[model samples]
Structure formats: C-alpha cells, structure tokens
Target: MFSPEGPTLRELAVQALSSVEHGYDLLAPKFDHTPFRTPDTVLESVAKALGPLGPFEDGLDLCCGTGAGTDVLAGLCHRSVTGVDFSAGMLDVARRRATGPVERVPAGPGTPGVAWVRGDARALPFTAAFDLVVSFGAFGHFLPRELPGLFTQVHSVLRPGGRFAFPVLAPPRPASPAFWMLLGFDAVMRVRNAVWRPPFVMYYRAFRLGQVLEELTRAGFTVDLRALPEFGRRDGGSPRARLVVARRPDGATPPPAA
Candidate 1:
C-alpha cells in the first residue's frame, strides 16, 4: 500500500524496470510513504528486543535506506552510528534526516553521532569498526548464493563478539492468499529478468531462514533467535516474527578498526 505522496504507478513501473540501485535512487524521495519501507512498529520491537544484549559502542546499519534502523542504533550505541547503502539518493535523504527535527528515540547524554556512507553490502568498507550491525528489509536484493559473501562482509566489519542482527518474518502458509501473491510476484520478477537488462532483484521467497542460519554458521557466527512477541504467534503457535542475532566469536582475532 502507498500513500498519496508515494510514487505514482507509472513512476513505480519506471523504477521496476531500472537497475536495483537506480530504482531505489528514483524511489528514495518517497520511500517512507510506501509500504516497502520497514514499519516503525518493527523497528521499535527490534530495539526493545536488542536492548538487554547491548550497551554497544560503535554500530553500523548495513543497507540502511533513509536511516530508520540507524536511528535505533543511535539510542543503543554509545560512540557512533554509521549507515551504509549503495544508493546515493537514499544516502542523501538519510543525511538530511539525521540533521532534521524528526522524533527519534531519545539517546541520553552520550547520543552517538551518525554518518552516512555509500557502499555495496557484498564489500563493506569498514575494518572491525563496529560492535553491532543491524539491517532491516534489505536482504531480498541479494540472491541466495550471495549469502555467504554477504555474511562474510558483515563478519569482517564487526569486532570480535560483536553482533549482526536483523528481523525476519515467518513465511506465509501455502494455503494463504499472501503466499500466492508473493509467489506470483517472484514469478513475474523472474520472467522480467529473463528479458530485462540490469536485473531488478527482489524476491519474497528466496531468503529462507534455515539456509540463512546455516550460512551464518558457516561464516563463523554463533547464531541465536529471539521471538518478537509483539507480532504475536501463528495458528501453529510459532512466532510470526523473529530476531536473528549472530555473533562473531570473541576468540577470533580481527584487524584493528579503521
């Protein structure tokens, strides 16, 4: 669903036909008005879930679009928060937001400073610089085969014992309309990519949780899952949403922070 201020259907068509980076650049200005942006409720829930596990220092928001998750990190991290994304348009919006009078979670006397950088997720440009890394609603751009390298990049940016955290929703039941909708969306995308240049990679079903956990483990993280009770349980009593907290072992030595 999109608000009146959101991109027009024609504008969305143009974006969908563009490369992922360019598409986001075109959509960046009105991104928050679209349902495509992560909901504030989810951000608040994740912040609450991560509160106890942190008193973190520097933090990074990987693939941060418009800086919602970075705002969460500003409250939790004491030193500094950096938001990195591949889209210059998105980064521009994020930068303006950091200096604006938006209502953000109050971060006490040591509120971390915020910075925005442009970089690809597959090759993050930081060295053991973050004690915590959080991402929200951006993984679908990456293919399943890219998970290992992506996780490795996340691992490389974190200090020893640092966490790479994100929230993931449980897949819809096959019987549900939502399931068919997502299936159809993915099918359309596949067909489009088959004929289109500069493939726009967004798939609802590609990021399987089980495969993701295995990749995180293979990438050297001690993975843990925490249920976000706010979203409530499904008919089967399983959590509808969960937070994945993957920590780099404290014993592993990493290069000095850049």
Candidate 2:
C-alpha cells in the first residue's frame, strides 16, 4: 500500500539488508510515501480521542519518524512540542518540513514551536520534561525483551500525571490473509536475524496487548484503555483499535533501575 513515489523494491532490499538505524536512514526520504508512516486518519482519530484528556504543557513524540505524530503533539500540547528519533535522516526531514506558525482555535496557541532531536528511546535525554508523550507505529522496531526498559525510559521522562499514550490495533484473525501475511513477515525476520548481523527487530506479532499493559503497570503507570470508536468493533464485539494511556502517578518517584 505504497504511493507511486515510495521506495522501490531495490531500495527496500537495500534497507532490509542494513541495520535498523541505517535502514531507517536510507528509507527516511521515502518513508511518508510508504504505508509505514502513520496515516492522518489514525492520528486525527487519536487527537480527537485525547482531546478531552489534554491541555498538556509540553509534549514529546517518541520515535517520531519524519514528525508525523509531532503534529498531533503540537495540537494537544500548549507550550511546545519536540520529536525524537534515532535516525538522523528522519530528523533532517522533520526539521526541513517543520511547522512554523502555530494554528489556534480548539487547542489554544502561541506560535507552535517544533524541535527535532536524534536519540535513543531506551535512554531518553530528558527527565520529567514532558507532560505528555505519544508514539505512533514505532513499537514494532523494539523487541519483546526491550519493552520494560523502553517503558521505564518513557516513564522517567514524564512528569507526574503525565501520560505515555499510543494506539494499539487488534491483530488480524488467524483465518485472515492479513494474519498470514504478518506471520510470514515475522518468519522471514526470524530467519534473517539468525543469519544476519546488527539485526533489524521488527515483528508485528511480538507486542501482545496483555503483556504491554502488565509492563506499563510494572513501570508504575496507571493504565487505561479507551476504544477508538471511529473504527468500529469486530464480529465478536471486540474493538478494532484502542488507545492505551499509561499515566505516571502524581508524585511518583523516579523509575527504578532494571
């Protein structure tokens, strides 16, 4: 589901052969054209859902590739917005396309500012710097074992009462072709990692909802799930998508070392 201007098959091959950082660097220019970039619809829906929750002061867009979610942060946060990603190329693109004048109406405004930083999610550069943090479509890059550390880092950067929120879509059913497609992708990734160096860890099936919630709780967040009703329920009445809001309790101490 790529646009006409997206990366070619050759480019994809080259990227897949490289390390995750290098691969994302190579793909940065064409990332927005690909389906890998979070869609405006989903971002808008999330913004709408979080609209009532905010009036947040400072915001951070974690793993903010090419700054898609940064816009959402700008809309939700009052003071300022910052986007952080590991890929320098992605940060470059984000700065180049940065929004200068802030729009005011619903979310209140005073010259919306944007900043891009190159950093690792597991070791954030800030401590209690943001009132809210939101990530989009970046969890697949992290392995299951890395979740606790990653969540802890996010927790460390958030002020008390601050939230670490993101959207979680339900996995496709085993009977569905989409499920098989993802399964095949994960299978290929496993084999690739076994034989490759500097492995690129991206598996759609690795991040389970139950495990994620428990980890958030372990990280000292008060967790809650809000169904995104824009995308309707499934056949069994399960929500098609959900927004997970993990808030660090007000006045909670620093995240314990893992």
Candidate 3:
C-alpha cells in the first residue's frame, strides 16, 4: 500500500523494468511513502532490543534507505552514526530525514552524531571501525548469490565483538494471499527481465534463513537468532520475526573473492 505521494502504478512498472539500482534511484524520492520503507514501529522495536547491547561508540546503518535503521543506531550508539546507501537519491532523502536528532522515550537525550554516505554495501569503505551495524528492509535488493559478499563487507566494517543485526520476518504461508501476491510479483519480474535490458532483483521468498546463516558463517560471522516475541510465532513454532545477530570474530579473516 502506498500513500498519495507514493509512486504511481505506471511509475512502479517503469521501476520494475529497470535495474535494481536504477529502480531504487527512481523510487527513492517517494520511497518513505510506500510500503517498501521499513516502518517506524519495526525500527523502534529493534532499537529497544539492541539498546542494552550498546552505549556503543560508533554504529553504521547498512543499505540505509531514508536512514530508518540509522535512526535506531543513533539512539544506541554513543559517539557517531553513519548511514551508507548505494543510491544517491536515497542518500539525499536519508540525509534530509536524518538531519535532526531522533525522538526517543522518557524524554532523554537524543542519538549520537549522524552522517550519510553513498556507497555499495558489497564494498564498504570502513575498516574495523564500527561498534554496531544494522540494516532494515533492504535485503530484497540483493540477489541470493550476493549475500556472502555483502555479509563479509559488513563484518569487515564492524569492530571485534560488534554485531551486524537485522530483523527477518517469516515468509508468508504458501496458502496465504500474501504468498500468492509475492508469487505473482516474482513471475511478472521474471517475464519482465526476459524481455528487459536491466534486471531489477527483489524476490520475497528467495532469502531463506538457513541459507542466510550459512552465508553469514562463511563470511566469518558467528550467527544467532533471537525471536522477536512481539510478533509471536508461526504454527510450526518458528518465530514470526527474528533479530539476527551476526558477529565478526576479534580475529576475522580477509574477505573472500566476490
């Protein structure tokens, strides 16, 4: 669902037919008004979960779209916060939106410092510099094959014992309408890519938890999943939402080939 200011059906069609980067560049201006942006509630919940893990000196928001996850980092981090995104248009929006201090409960002090950078997540520019890193609602942009390199980059940026966190929602049931909707969307994307020039890469069901853990481990991260009880559990007893904390070891290995 999109707001009145969100992209039109025709605009969305144009974006879907373009490359992933180009589509995000086109959508970035009105992205926050669309359902694709990570919601404030999810951001807040993640902040609450990560708060105790911090008072961290520095934090980074990976693939920070409009800096939603950056806002969360600002709260938990003590000295500085950085939001990095590949799309310049998206970075512009994030810079504007994350300019002021973030709002928080109990009327306490605002977040740590904030900055925005335009860069690819697969090739982060920082070293063992950040105490924490978080991303939200941006995984769909990356194809399954890219996950290892992406994870490795994030791990490379984080300081020893630092976390690379993100929330993963359980996939909709096969019999559910949401599942059918995603299936149809993916089918349309397949058709469009067959005849189109640049391919947009976003798939609802491709990023499986098992595959993710394997990649994270291969990327030199010790992975753990903490169930987000607020979202409850599925019929098979799996969590509806999970906070994945992937930690790069103190002596992390050099990143493998892309």
Candidate 4:
C-alpha cells in the first residue's frame, strides 16, 4: 500500500522491470511514502531492543536506503554513524533528508554525526571500523546463495565484539492471507526474472531464519535473538518479531573463505 505521494502504478511497473539498482534509483524520491520504507514503529522497536547492548562508538547502516536506520544509529552510537548503499539516487535523497527538518531520533550533544556512502553491501568499503552495524528491510534484494558472502562482508567491517543487528518478523502461517500474498509475490518475481533481462532480484520468501543464523555463525558471529515485546507473540507462543544480534567475537578475525 502506497500513499498519494508514492510512486504511481506506471512508475512502479517501470521500476519492477529494471535492475534492482536502477529500480531503487527510480523509486528513491517517493520511497518513504511507499510501504517499502521501514516503518517508524519497527525502527522504534529495534532502537529499544538495541539500547542495552549499546553506548557504541561508531555505527554503520548496511544497505541504508534513505537513511532510516541511520536515525536509529544516531541515538545508540556516540561517535559517528554512516549509511551505505549501492544506489546513488537513494543516497542523494538520504543526504537531502538528513539536512531537512524531518522528525527523527533526537540528536543530543553526544550524538554521532551522520554520513552517507554509496557502496554495495556484499562488498562494503570499510574494514573493522564500526562497533555496530544494522540493516532494515533490505534483505529481500539479496539472493539466498549470496548470504554467506554478505554476512562475511558485514563481519569484516565490524570491529571484534561489534554487532550486526536487524529485526525479522516471524513468517506467516500457511493458512493466512499474508502467507499467500508473500508466496505469490515471490513467485511473480521469479517468473519476471525468468523472462526479463537485468533481473530485479527481490524475493520475500528467500531469507530463511535458520539459514541466516548458520551463515552468520560460519562468518564468525555469535548470534543472539531477542524478542521485541512491542509486536507481542504469535499464536504458537513464538515472538512476532525478533532482533537478530550477531556479534563478531572479541579479538577475532573473519573466517577464511571456503
């Protein structure tokens, strides 16, 4: 669902047909008005979950589309907060918004200065520089096969004992309408990629939690899952939302490539 200021149907169709980078570039200006942008409620919940683990020095927001996650880092990190993404258009919007008067986490005297960098998440352009790294609503753009390399990159950029945090929602039950909606969305995306060139890689069902935890462990992170109380619990008593906090072990380096 999109607001009146969001991308039109024709604009969305054009974006869906383009490469992921180009599609996001096309969508950047109106992204906040679209449901694709991470919600404030989710951001607030993540900020609350991360509050105890932090008082961190430097932070990075991986795949930081329009810098929503950067706002979260600004509150938690003390020294600096950087937002990195592959899309120049998204960075432009983020930069502009950062200078604007938009409502965001209150930046106190110790609040870190924010910066935006254009870089691919799979090959982030930093090394052991950040105490914390976060991502929001960007995983679907990455294929399942790419998870190991991606996690490795996140690991490489974080200082030993630093964390990579992000929130994940529990998958909907098979009988639910939301389940069918996501399944159909992924199916359509697969079909579109099969028939199109410069494939737009966005699939809702590809990032399984078990596979992610394994890859994070293989990448040298001790993973912790914290339930977000704001979203409550599912019918089966599992958390509706959980924050995946993967910490690179103290004084440890990334694992050697396979």
Candidate 5:
C-alpha cells in the first residue's frame, strides 16, 4: 500500500481482517516499503542518543520487524544483539536483513553480533539476558490493560541495571488534524473489533504516555526521558519525540509477599 513494492490495497484489506500474528506474516515481506517500518532518521537518532549510555554486553530489539532496531543495537552494543518477534515471516525478513547491507554505528570500538528469534512480547522467553532492549512502532498492537504484563516481561529479560527504551512522539495537539485522524482511526478499529471475531487489538489512541509511565514504574523500572534532538521541538518547547529509557534496578526479583 505504500509503494510499488508494498502490499496492494486488496492485500492490506485481507491482512487487516486477519489475526494480528497472521496479518504481520502477510505483511512481513513488504513491511519495509510501508510507513510502518521505523524511519532511518529515527533509528539514527536513537543510535546517537544511545551511544553514550552503552558498552552494553547483550541487547535486544523487542518486536523487531525487519531488523531496523537490531541494526541500531549492532552499532551500540559491544557483545551481542537479538531481535525477537512473534511472526515467522517477519523473522525471516529480519534474518535476511542481518545478512544483507549492515547498518554501521560507530558507538564504540567493537561490532556486536546479531541474531533473530520469533517470540511473543507479552510472554518473552528469556531471563536476565539483555542489557538494553528497544522496540519501535509495535506498541499499538498491545491493549492498554496488557501494559503491565508486557512491561513486566521486558523487565524479566533485562539484566539488573538494563534499559528498556523506545521513542514516543508527543501526542498531537487536540485541535490538530493529526489528532482527529488518530481519533477516527481508533473509532474505526473499535467498531471493527466489536463485530469481528478474534479481534485485531490495534488502536492508535490506546497507549497514553501517562498510563505507560505508570506501568513502567510499577514494573520496577526507574524511568527517564531523553530528548531526540533530530526531530526538533514543539512550540511549547517539549521535544517532538522523546526516548523513554526505563532501567531495571540491580536486585533479585522479590518473592510474592504472603
């Protein structure tokens, strides 16, 4: 739908009607041609911002579709980088990307190893494995109620003092066309889910920054915001896009208090 190489309109329609996992499988091959892939500018900005914070041993690209964020990690982390997602089709594309033209990041002295694994974000499959985890453009697939468990899963995989980071654009002003467009999109998605079996849970307005920060805090991470200088700023002086860097504290997971 985004380019000649992208999915056709009829193909997008078929994908939208299918389950999220299968829909992505359908979209995987052409995802890079669509606007859905994180832009190179954003990835470069993230790589620059993360450069000073690193020397991280192992990193992860949570929900890494096509390895855009994985490449960012390859440049930033010193040891190894992993990209995990639920769609095998997406993973296939990501694996291909790892072997293709590599994105070079001069974060430091060493080149990080890259790997791809297919897995779900809600129930991640690692423990104390990563020092930095970053995701892009996948939060909308998750419902609001699932934030806690999702963040908890990110928390579980990150080593003590590890960071879970993602760039979030500032919500559009209420009077802006972007805001109304998002509202309309969410409304349509709501109606679609109401009548459709095995509802596709994507919603544009569901992931509020306030609620997300609260969940990140509750997930036992101390969170901070870093400005992404490339996107510039709003009239109000807030960054156009800010990177949320949530750090898992250095301690053992506590037992449930009986």
Candidate 6:
C-alpha cells in the first residue's frame, strides 16, 4: 500500500509515538507517498459526482492534508479555493504542491488563486464564507462524541444552502477479514491510548456512517447521500463509497447553543 517514497516503518513508529499535531507535522513531508493519502481515483470520482452541484464561488477543503481535496476545490470553485489544516508542516507541502506540475480542471479564467490556511476543524476561523466545504480521509481523527461540535463547526462556516460534503466508504462486513483487521486496529489503539502519553488519535474503525448522518442532522444540516458508482457495489448492491452531502438551509438560523 506504500511505496519506497513513503516513510519507513521506523519513521512511522516514531511519528505514531508523537502527539497528533506533532506526529502529522513529522509525517507531512512523506504523506503523499503513503497509503494514508487520498487516492487520485477517489478524488476524481468525487469531483465528477460534485461537478453538477458546482460553479461554486468559494470552497474550503477541511483537514486538507497535503491538499488532495484542494485540487478538487480548485477545479469546481470559481471565486477562490482555500485548504485549512492545523499542521503547518502539512500546509507547507500543500502550498508547494500548488506550484507543482499537477494539472487540474480549470474553474475558468475568472477563478481566483488557491490559498492554504492553518486552522483547527473543531473551531474554524471563517463564518458564512464558503459555498462548498469538503473533507477527505480525516474523520477517524475525531471521536464519535466530538461529532456534534465538529458538524456544528462545519455548519457555522457555510453560507445558508452551502454544502458540507465528504465521502464515506461502506464498512466491511463483520465476518470479513478487512473488518477484523480494522476492529483489531481500534482495539490496539484503545489499549495504546490508555498507556501512551500524548496519544495518537487515529482509529480505522471508529467512524460509523449511521452515527455521522444522525449528527449531521442534529447540527441542522439537511443531509443526502449519493452513491459513487466508480467503486462498484457489494452483493446487496450498495455502492462501495457514498458522498454525504449536507446543506445548511438557506437563510436558516442555527439552533440555540447549550
């Protein structure tokens, strides 16, 4: 799953031992070469699904590590594109990638330049700024209990009617080897967090689709799910990956805070 260009096992071990922020900073340089980076195929497939939804004015790629989704935003958004992440090291790589040889779908000559911002996803700095917001491969970093606040943050930054979107892969069946692997990974992380200081907060099996949809609704988003056909389907005919598109209602006010 990882190339020679990716971090070595020793490097990964050291990073995993660090705090989440510091660990990502350490991993930032070699992130793209790792399997942890979102694949081009997934990005392309998502962009295609979101194509009709756009001609968006402004966009944000939340928790944009090394800016994979930012490229998608640059393609779909006409006014401006910004990627926000907490890790400055990751932001540095993202900024460098902006000038690299990667070809992107043009948002037209009228499109403003792309920008990278360093910020926390739990408390975004922007307010009613972006027409579109997308995150990829970063949800597991957030605990289930944090979903409400995280969704609220996403809701707050979006203009009324603006969409907060991300892709969700269907969980592997309980009997599947992939499922057992993820389950074991989470069990290991639980034990690790119990013993380790400055715990590394990634878990493969923590983010559940049902809970996520429920939390999005509680956060005042009108949610919808669209299947990405490119990844094909299971025996039950459900698509392998689904795009969770949640829109903040136009001109609607957020509910009273506790």
Q: TM-score of predicted model 1?
A: 0.94
Model 3 per-residue lDDT tens digits across residues 125-213:
88888989999987877889989888888877888888999999999998999999999988877787788787777877778889999
The sequence of per-residue lDDT tens digits that candidate 1 reaches over residues 1-258 is 889999999999999999999999999999989999899999999999999998899899999999999989887898788899999999989988785333333345677777788899998888998999999999999999999889988999899989999999999999999999999999999999999998999999999999999998888899999999999999999999999999999977533322
Model 5 lDDT at residue 208: 90
C-alpha lDDT (0 to 100) for residue 107 of candidate 5: 32
Q: Return model 3's CA RMSD, one decimal.
A: 3.4
lDDT of 6 at 138: 98
Q: Which regions of candidate 1 fall more than 4 Å away from where they truly are?
A: 100-108, 253-258
- List the global CA lDDT of all models: 0.91, 0.90, 0.83, 0.91, 0.86, 0.88
- Can you write out model 4's per-residue Cα lDDT over 148-226, one digit (the tens) per residue? 8999999999998899999999999999999999999999999999999999999999999999999999989999999
Worst 10 residues of 2 by lDDT: 100-109
Single out the weakest 10-residue window by summed lDDT for candidate 5.
Answer: 100-109
Tell me each candidate's TM-score: 0.94, 0.96, 0.92, 0.96, 0.93, 0.95
Name model 6 segments beyond 4 Å from true. 100-108, 256-258
lDDT (C-alpha) at residue 131 in model 4 = 96
Worst 10 residues of 3 by lDDT: 101-110
Order of candidate numbers by lDDT, starting with the best: 4, 1, 2, 6, 5, 3
Residue pairs in collision within model 6: none
lDDT for model 2, please. 0.90
For model 4, the stretches where C-alpha displacement exceeds 4 angstroms are 99-108
Off by over 4 Å in 3: 101-111
